[model samples]
Target: MRLRQLLLAITLVFTVAISPIQTDAILAEDMAIIVEVEGDPNKWKAYIEDYHPFVEVIHVYDTLLNALALKGKSKDLYDIDKEDFVRTIHPAQKYEVPNAAHSPSPIKPPKRNVNTPYTGKGVKVGVIDTGMDYSHPDLKRNYKGGYDVVDFDDQPMETLPTEGMPTLHGTHVSGIIAANGEMKGVAPNADLYAYRALGPGGVGSSVGIVAALEKAVEDGMDIINLSLGNSVNSPDWPTSIAVNKAIEMGVAVVIANGNAGPDNWTVASPATSVKALSVGASITEIKIPYLTIPLEDRKLPLQMLVGSPEWNFSKPYQLVNGGLGKEALPDVQGKIVIFKRGEIPFSEKVQVAEKAGAVGVIIYNNEEGVFQGGLTETTSIPVAAMTKEDGEWLLQKGKEKWAYTSYQLVKDKLAPFSSKGPVVANWDIKPEIIAPGVEIASTVPGGYQELQGTSMASPYVAGVLALIKEAHPDWGPNKLKAAVLSTAKPFKNETGSLYQPIEQGMGAIQTEKSINPEILIYESRLTFGKINEGVKEKKVDIVVENRSEETKKFRFDYPHHESGVVWDIPQTFYVKPKEKKHITVGLRVNSRKLEKGLHQGWLTLYNGNDEVYLPYLFVNETADYPKIDGVELTLSPFEQDKFKYSMYLPDGAEQLTIDLYEPESLRYVKTIVEDEEVKPGMHEGIINRGEFVENSYLVFVKIRNGKTYDSFVTEFQNFPLQP
Candidate 1:
């Protein structure tokens, strides 16, 4: 009886120990994740591995991001996450290249403005993207040594066909910056360093990007140009923070704002990083097609569909309405067809128009405002898009009205695809300035190709900065940024409304005016963020540095007084040569009297013949921004049992909870994160599968920033443990 009782006790102990973990629990096979830790990395790795046997440390990043890239069994990762030494867990996010043509030269290359244009001589500019064709004649002279984080090698060349998709992006971008042989770059003499973080097919991961930044900073690059970015728009995203840190280290960081534009808040990081020189795409001095009512003096600008032949019309053509462009029209032959955008593919519409023997195709947006579109396949004839209002007016004018084509040739027009922003948390204007990106001709691999995107535009700015750096070697990143922002040529949109601080970002770069700046405008943009009704007065200071060797008098050209806003302009001030003066600008806003939308205008400061315009803007009440962003869930690659989840709180949240539900049945599952206080920035942890039921789950992240509550939803399949 004693022996049997002892055996029963042992059995019970074993059962209790294993009960918390279900055998049939849903688990990850093997997954990659990043863990932030504070103490000694080596000791922490050992401690983590000793406690969680399945965890594997892939790489340790000590420079830019003090974190570890780890792979492990899902269940074990959760156990490791529970330890106090561990901090935030990040999903190794996958990133793809932001997809780029003649971009007219945004600025006349510096040569025309000055006798000896600064070609980035001796300046090291790093290109962090897919590897480049370093051997390309245009780039070879400027190409220097670099690291390949993807392959963990010293050879930072474009991926070979034997490995994956060959890339010419890095080459094109490099050529745009410092190409010296066949075609001239912005800075033909600037030294180029390549960081091949992205691999085949122009796809990579967050860890890779972080690693690239680390390497670039370690290499002591004078200016780092990241022509790549992810869709996350948060200012505190890991890479964005890294960029901010990089700038603090005295290296100028320039990043592509993203290609998902003409909408506000579409800008992506690390362009969202506060100090980075975030660039936007603009057009060069080239004429694009538009439609006119010859005698009416009325014109409808057309945004040519990407992948369609350029619209070239020497004379007017007959017009007909082809409803939706879904069906072929009987009498559309020998005429221009106008189709409503909907239902059918744009290429299909063009094909239909072609079958009807139409001379050209024009697609009018069914919704309000203009839209950018593309054809799946190249069309034989030209096609373009217009606003819904234009469509209605065109249909009202009747088919008998001939559509005469003309060119809206202008320099520095904002590209429809270049992303815009007021960063989520900071509400700072992004793409601080624009450069030409449309149909920009630059070096590819063996030769050259005309590609377009903020990607192409980025190198232009990089080159410009290189030249400026050559001219002003003593300038820091902030000064360099200020030089460009204060001098860029601000312009109005096609609608005659001044581009908002978010949309145009102080306008396009003017090489001649910016290359030799005499004064640096600190915090070049005057932003009064989101003001509450209680906040009647706000003040931001701008430091004026007199770089020129003479004392200069500064005066403010007062903005047109509006009833709602009262300006506190400082009286005339003077700064001695080589001295810095801080001027405080204040605004008293009456919320009740202000309009409902974004209020923005320019304030001009003049010193002698030199002038600097500061763009100021603010939102009256609640700003239009995403409160919750950068939500990610990563499944383990080694085992199937557990997963790591991460989320970013733009502003510290008073209460936060993640509720899980059955995806198909709408059944409430469990709350993983209870109403807990979370601070600003990234928060991540591993979760045990046993906490959830066996069903596909829909996740809802509920957050409260003060009294305001917001929720974001996502879904994933759930796996149950085996009995």
Candidate 2:
């Protein structure tokens, strides 16, 4: 789910050989970039500045990352990249801050239900996103000094609308962590620092993010919250590595898993950073809208989209298919309009429907599961989203629906939009925890606003971490993370099936329990990775630390029965007071006897009656996921009149080909490349220059695996060369 938006065109500095970290094409025009070096960045910067007059050295990050941020033409950078000292030339990536749609007005912030023992007194929390509105009453008290990488200034302020897309995201996130005025956050007394890495429109690049991280560490930040991320899902990405280094330096990092939800492998960096605490979206107790038919068993559970009013109509209204809700319709007064979600924004669809005199709106999923969406503009009537199944059923049945009307509280449910994970290269359970992200009311620039996404959920956990840090000032970052994970509460879905660890990780945070756990466990969950047919067993070790003065006894609880799985359990044992001991757990599996797919469950460890659940899973052979992703086109610099195309082939393709079609109409044009035998990993090539019959065409990548053949249609306008 890589979001496509118009990005800045700039010069790219790099070697002829490119790393997978780059997604955007290197243009001949001057652009900003980060040049990673194997040698000292300071020395590299000095040498570049002294020798290369064409290149502008922005910043040298030598401490945490040996990289030089620069602005120059791709040609000039390429010449410098010829030196062996340069590691990789990285294109400045557009990292977006995830925030659900927001309304023009503020919502009433919820009051704290219970008082906590610690309020993060004296702890320093750094917010790295769009700069905070320090002028806001709720945030001003805790607002500390910070630098602005976006505008290169000392004042880090949220941009005004005159600037790009005016932002309130960082302010909202900051309020969630430490707002102490009319609205009190989880750690209301903590010191807050703002790093405006993202500017107008909440958009930023990799260099700014890395620079911000370096500055935060220099300022001695105890904890850092990054609600920003890119769609590239790789653990080895520069940002992910940078986060890992920060954690190594004893800084706790909390990041939003992503907004691309319910999909496996959608967790983006640096949330994919193994050491950082990744958080997903979940819900607290709240009532949502539902639709029912008189005699039908299908009841559509609807999420009242943010920036829209509640659905108060209890009576059935006539339903009409709006055909994607992009165009106008006649004779639709007082009827409920149904829209299949795609192409247009939720706000636009709702606005169109509202303007057409529709009483209510239903924008159904373009994908499998239900989604949480927002309207930028508040609508006069209620609007909601349903699952693809229910939406299609309505398309067939075409029935007017009645509302549930009564209270049905959804508690501890995973937000449909929170990204899930078993990270690609090494299978790791991301979002090591979950928190309330649905309609969370927090501080905006002008006042309190309710915005949803893992963005809000991340700060909630960061505030929790602050409280934990205050309670145990002597603990390291890993210990703090372990305490939080071991003491969390796992949730079950409506079907009574516990949500998988990959979906909710250790589940929602338990504030009080995490701050003062009886015992702490490190290496929260065991990820066994992909187990092939021949492999019979796998072993993982977890460290448990006793916090009590007395020795603690622990025993392993049997996992639910799976035909081919056997446990190598340790006998009940006692751990010395305040001692940390390594405990081994083994999973012996007979692959032939078990079903050949993803097999997962939980193993419980008990100390007396209190229990700690550890999650483990492995795929047999390999999961049938897409083998290719992200096809991008750029003009070749070395060749004449040729377009350079790049794509990632995770598992090499048996066959790879590109097909061109007429844009909008989708009429077939011609083939660009048809390779019968394609290699694995990243693939790139320069297309042969040919004459074009048309000015523009859509580009598609057709790939083949064992039994699956899929075509990826991508939007590319006006490839100037041969069509």
Candidate 3:
């Protein structure tokens, strides 16, 4: 009885332990988000007016007609979360105001004159993103005809509701291509065609995005701006293939490098599609002085806290929760407030303390691993946070004297979360360039707000492409991609730096230099053909021609792996000054049943090294050809289960061939069903040998390929063979 009772207890304990875990596992798969808005824009405006320059609010509309009509006015009728707002009045025309109270650095824009000629004149740039606000002051003049592929509405172009739609993300992006004035775009005069694929939720299915690209291509868009993307895993995604086809047709495709952050090199889909020019995010640091908020008139330090180190000395203390309680105000008026990170929303944390009359609030991390949290557009008061340990220290310090310090939040080079990349899965040269993307002040759903991501980086490139396209109207998409890639500054990613060149791409796109350059231009397009599975030895053929007048000494370079690749000639090849030559590169795959996938590598060609290779040859080298490898695996099963297997033998492979099959007991059986010869990596095969076993079987294996092994016995197993 005792033994049975003990066993029952063990079983009950096991059941109880596993049941909760199983339930939790099921619950984890479900994801959801709930947002609560307590007040309207009018209520927020009274509070917003307290912050300076009214600079963060810029409305990016599809057309500038409305903004121009409004002339110069600062109204709260704008999307507070959006960037890239159209400028109703030029920066020079308006009086400079003080920067934001917590301003980091002065906003620095690329230098451009009103009369500067940019490339994209007659060309049309198709923007596929959230809807565009056609009435935006800066973007209106450049707005052309476009379609909304999402809902397919007749007036696909309508003024989206400010509160419900941040349809302005596309408009802000459009401005980057053509916004004029103190903030000059790469192509200020380029025509714009906008498409709304993503809706208010800031999300879209793969089908919608790809459909938009196809439509853009059909509409004769010279350049397509894809500032949004998901993680890249395979080359089979529809958008990926479509983008590749677009490049082949001479259409310049620019996409975002993704904002996944600080890692070595990460790549997002569409951008990873090899053919697209991937752009990364950079910050255009802008600094402004004279912006300050009054600490008295409104509510000086609405939140507050009180603590005494004399607690250890048995001092009586009272804990109280004053202020608005559940109302939208802070807590502990005029005193410091301490809060935890989880449970409550950060905005609510600030609000709770604000109503309490607390002058400051410090939030400590709730997650075991993290200790710091950044302030968002919601948080008010001189808010700061620290780790649990740091928070405790600050609490102790507060008991002595409250310290109120103003922090100047300047724009940094790159946001910590900005995605890094050397282009993962395969390090194909990506992030072809970088552009401003973090906390970028632009137009939003209602008015202006600071937003960041690769979404911002892409438009920067698009705008630049517009400039280049306008400058050289005759250049095709291939020429355009090359020009941008070649002109990019060679940059390397440091351990803890803001920009990682390989991941951020060729380097941040220098708006000024892309319009002009020195040396051989990148003007060629690289197209890859299918690589069959059976091919044991494949040859890659490429051509490098001189696009210059003088004899250009060229150096041949492509991604190298001694085991897989072998080039035809010496490292350096000279094109009779202006001659063109076809070079052949060979690759040998030494494996069988290889999986089908895309592989990419850079085939860099340069002439004379800077002072390093003067004596070798003063040849003006050519810069072009980023090579690619596209492998197509085709394996046809000969018999079946015995199709293929790899095992290393000490004696080495001599003659490999299936002899016969024998079954063992009632365990299982595996038949020598099918076998076939695989190319590139060769192996002997025995097909339809009629070798079959019901249960478990032993098969005699022989190798006939070489003279290493005469014969051997191998066992095969089966698991309810269906066919």
Candidate 4:
């Protein structure tokens, strides 16, 4: 009965596409062979019952037998199978997986919250993937409802016939978003919904995705996480359109930037859609290993994991050592394989050790702390890494047969595989931010596992976005995107090379930076105008205000402008004697936009030359013009000698506020101003000065927002007797 319904469903899908089911040629590439399996239900069942010889079987293209035909075992069957089965069916096509070609795992970027709470507690995040393992402890409590789009079943419950379904890929992906603590997701407080868009084989159709997305939209999801994408590009693809619709309806869509990278790089379809938040990958530190030795050898440290706590190597789990390239490597089939870091892809070395039957793999760094590398999907063994000194000690001790065993894996810091980018193609600035993608400990089916990939990076983003959305319910993708992108510090690569905003797009997404609630910035993102070559000028008004305490002393320096042009903004501005103020910079362009090209440069603001650049992109035109609103300020006096101060300024407010406890002793006190509401061109009184004080105090002030507005201390000496 189930087979009859499945066949009927297949027929309907075939009829819907109009074109004969011309299976994509790429689908054939991964399978070993194509066999003629008669469409008749009896024959298909008989084959499965009597001769189950294939390694991996996929009922692709609705009834096509995608089976692996091994060389020796299937030879006799091929001869007889062709005569009996060939006439009953017929060879359709041939395909095979590329040599060593496999899908890449997108890295989960390391999240950087601006140090505010933004958990999407009441919001729902829908994950469209294979069925989630709802029974898993970490996910069970959060499971709202999920539909197996593949089977048209409403839930991943007992009713669905999952006879030959694929593994739990969807479950793992869902865990990355909604898994409870122990394997906590970024937005642990958010609600979860799932849609099984993929089958057991981690494959799904375009129509299924559309169906799932449409359902999610109807269900009113705040964010939709799509980990699947089409291998081949098609502009009119249904999934792309569905995702775009979801975005139009105020849903933030997070899609995988396709795991096909390191070459021929392009984010897949839905990810490529303008509305989608295409996420890439980053490497992060994960689980740690413990190495035990006698107390006397404490001075000779094993390996140190960065940002990870020290492990008591003297705990349970027996330790043993073996020499490098040794035939029998520490007999680690069920234990952690402790190996020194050296030449070759870490995956290759780990695989060899695993082939020697090692269970868990541990490679210590070649330096002092931890070293980083990527693991292959084919290797299922849990791998933990350490530092170079640890590897050396292990090598030295292996000569002396020191027992070493690691109990758990601890994350030290961000990993190296996490690809950094200022998006190359769109040049729209990609990799909006970095997150904990590599070796992250997230919930897995049945238990916890440390997984890595850009796949992991994206959900961290989705989870964080959920939190931001939770806090600012009014923020749209544009504001959220801008807040995330604009606030990221211009990060430098490992080699100290300045990372362009185009490559590490918008810099790494810093969660800590996104939830500050208040941001001081230039009202306009891109200053626009047209100016003729030679002595042309445009004055862009910049708002300056203080988000923190202390009067601001501001100046713009180190102008990085394109050739054939000279530019200038206000060289200097001030907030107040001891409070934030608003100011503007005047810009003069000496030349016009030449030859219809973009002229780009950086504007660095100096609070004593700790320079940070504000990126500018200008299109070449006949002329250019730039303008900004002037600053607004207001002050109220609480007494004849004391006043409460406040101001309203733009995001790029040139203002700072400072607090002083003592009229004279201003150096040691940790003084700060809390959230103050001041708009451009206005100020209000906030501070109060009372009675009499014996001593004087000093206070320090810095730009809490780090953008346009900043400040310094204004000396308040001993107070005189009130008149």
lDDT of 2: 0.78
lDDT of 3 by residue, 98-143 (tens): 1111222234544332344554678788888776666655556777
Q: Where does candidate 3 stray beyond 4 Å?
A: 1-116, 154-167, 181-183, 284-346, 353-415, 422-427, 443-450, 492-501, 516-545, 554-571, 576-606, 609-723
Question: TM-score for every candidate vs. truth?
Answer: 0.77, 0.87, 0.53, 0.48
- A best-first ranking of the candidates according to their lDDT comes to 2, 1, 4, 3
Q: Point out where model 2 deviates above 4 Å.
A: 1-7, 10-33, 47-56, 71-94, 99-106, 112-114, 328-334, 399-407, 635-644, 652-715
What is the lDDT, from 0 to 100, of the residue 297 in candidate 4? 58
Using lDDT as the measure, which candidate wins?
2
lDDT of 3: 0.47
Give the root-mean-square deviation of each candidate in angstroms.
8.9, 5.1, 20.7, 27.1
Error of 1 at 641 (Å): 5.1
Ranking 3 against 4 by lDDT, winner = 4
C-alpha lDDT of all candidate models, in order: 0.75, 0.78, 0.47, 0.48
Query: For residues 2-70, could you state the per-residue lDDT of candidate 4 as single tens digits?
Result: 111111112221011211122222212222222333455345534644564442332222211212222
lDDT at residue 349 of model 4 (Cα atoms): 61
Clash totals in order:
29, 5, 97, 121
Worst ten in a row by lDDT for model 3? 611-620
lDDT tens digits by residue: candidate 2, 1-723: 000111234212111222222322453556555567887888988898888889888877777877777777766766776667777533345697744344545456755423677999989999999999999998999998787877666889997767856788999999999999888899999999999999876878776788889889888999999998887666766688889999999999999999888888888778989899999989886686667666666667777776677677766677889978788887778888889999888878888888889999998999887676666665788888888898998877765554333336787798888998877666788878999998788888777767788999999999988998988887778988998899998989999988999889988899888888879999968887777786488888999999899999999888777777888879697899999999888888887887766666788889999988888878777774445654556533434354556665666678888988888798988898888667765576767645334556677789887786877776554323322
Error of 1 at 35 (Å): 5.9
Q: Tens-digit lDDT track for model 1 on 1-723?
A: 011111111112101222223322423335455567777767787776677667887667677766665666555666666677667433455566732211222222222122455666888899999877888876788888898877666899987668866666787788888888757888889899999988876777666788888889888899999888887888777688888998999999888888878778889878889999889988877677767775666778887765556688888898888898766688677798889999887878889889889989889988776776655444678888888998788877745978877886777578887898888766787878888888677776556665668888888888888988998898889888888887887767788766777777878888767778777778878888776674389899989888789899999999888988999988699999899889999999988887655677788888777666688878787665677777776444223355556666777588888888887888887888765678777776667756666556788889987778999887665555555
On TM-score, the stronger of 2 and 4 is: 2
